[model samples]
Target: MTLLDQPTGPSASVWPPDAHGPRRDPAPLLPDPEPFRMLGTPAADKLDPELLRDLYRRLVLGRRYNQQATTLTKQGRLAVYPASTGQEACQVAAAAVLRETDWLFPSYRDTLAVVSRGVRPVAALTLLRGNAHHGWDPKAHRTAPLCTPLATQAPHAVGLAHAARLRGDDVVALTMVGDGGTSEGDFHEALNFAGVLNAPVVFLVQNNGYAISVPLSKQSAAPTLAHKAVGYGISGRLVDGNDAAAVHSVLTEAVEHARSGRGPVLVEAVTYRLEAHTNADDATRYRTSDEVVAWRQRDPLAVLERHLREHDLIDDAGVAAAAEAAEELAAEMRAEFHSEPELDPMSLFEHVYAEPTPQLREQADLLAAELAAEADPR
Candidate 1:
């Protein structure tokens, strides 16, 4: 039974709201009525010119990376790719706000963020390529595996943050999840635990409008994803996911809040997934062309570029330089992915356990024996 359903006694009268309900003070947790925008605003003038340039370059490369990765999928180099074509701002800013020493726990859609976090581009796609369990070493890069299971990474981020606090480590764990993931039990548990433990972690929800074939309208009826944070006693922030400057500014604040021992914070970046959920899904089946076109007008890269140009921070030469660099990166990825990778079937059993069980060892031996026989006979 829920707490609200419990029988109320004389002592219950002393409780706040007389046990009617949680009656949480939500004023402090309310997100802005509209998603915060900065690219075209006067506030954009105050931002550092170099930082704006950096964001623009990253956005350019990030867009190119998404295109190349999607192309790789079509070419059979990558098993599948969930492109962040229109959501480059969220990806880039998520990384830009983080320190190298900080940990990033990313969902499968966050490969761009992983790459921006200093992981080699090729290594970040290892899992997506189906060549390895994870693309990079978690301990080495301070990035967890790209989680395919929805909302599971939330709890992992909370656990790591809580542990770091216990050990007196000066670290913050920023976990990224999609809006749909907010409905999962793990998401609730993680938020609740983080709030109670005062863990230094930031939860970023990229509200990309749809969860696969499902639209946000079919999802939870929460006013905004950020509002969910208030229930957990954590701060909530909302920002225009298409505005890189706004995303970076908001995330920077949230990260600083967590790092300062103020407890966990939740940020919802309002973005739209312009592409299909993956190369395998047909977006045309669910969305209209006009809708896609509308979002394209506010494209993250274009918005930032326009802002920079208006401020005289970048000109045609700068744009060309950025594009050229992006092309080079894309070319490098294409060449690297075309090369065949060495594989060992036996290696799969190696990392599954520290000490393999007798049953596992027997299975491994059986596979090995079968391989050896086939090698000699065929």
Candidate 2:
């Protein structure tokens, strides 16, 4: 049989059905691979209309927030910022399925996910503005601080899951990392430990293809990153990351699995990064324009918005209103950042340790004296 007409079954032999003679060529590896199964398929039609509308609003807000943050950084308001322009679907969908009781360990680019989960916009900005050690307390909201060091949050999530298991808390830890981060040793270590300990955690890897200019092909030789979990002896899934509904469904299943004490699962979200790595990095330097154009067609916000409109959950006017409201909120947040009190350099040592060291005390005193000396003596 021709390659196009080859039987897709376990019984089908690598030799063609009509091959009456000895095989002239070596068989190709992995001919009839199992079809990629998506989680949450059965639940698509069961989503509430109100939740769909809320998802749309959150998507728009996330897009607007990233845009404004980029503009602000360019205008000298922020030190540096990461943009989650094209990955809203993964963030929003996964966030929507989470309970407030669930724990979240997010990277810096996951501001959209945090915001969707009720993190105040201004509070998130506090980290970017160098005003707070962390955006919010993890114990208070069950969300960890934004991890700037790549892939470091994965193991932290594992620790949280271990703690929850010990305390007999029915909470799951959902940790997110980029496709590029999967190369880090921390990522592998976390996955292994979670599997061995049967930790209640979900590893969500947003595979946007390029890890700061290094393409996914260079990052791994595995056919699919989700397959990495097989070595760790855990469940793994690969999903269409651009489809918010699909993401939501898969994450809901994963969360349920963890809550039911099924151990850990790894989800590889096959998506793309639409914008540059940051406002600073130039995508044109490495990626082709054709690639950007192709991924642009799969924009998650546009896909979800279309889905909502077709379902009649929202109208054009409703979308417009959401955008307007998001703009107002962004403006208010910007104003709040501007009005924040100046950082006290002396206060930097205040929370460094449980008890202050003599050297730290002396440094603090020196800083206070310098500030006092610099004050106007009118």
Taken over the whole model, the C-alpha lDDT of each candidate is 0.91, 0.81
Give the TM-scores of the predictions, in the order they appear: 0.92, 0.83
- Model 2 clashing residue pairs (backbone): none
Local lDDT at 100 for model 1: 76
- Model 2 off-target regions past 4 Å? 1-47, 355-378
- Which candidate comes out best when scored by lDDT? 1
Cα deviation of 271 in candidate 1 (Å)?
0.4
Please list the residue runs of candidate 1 whose C-alpha ends up more than 4 Å from where it truly belongs after superposition.
Answer: 1-24, 357-359
lDDT of 2 by residue, 157-195 (tens): 999899988998888999999998899999999999998
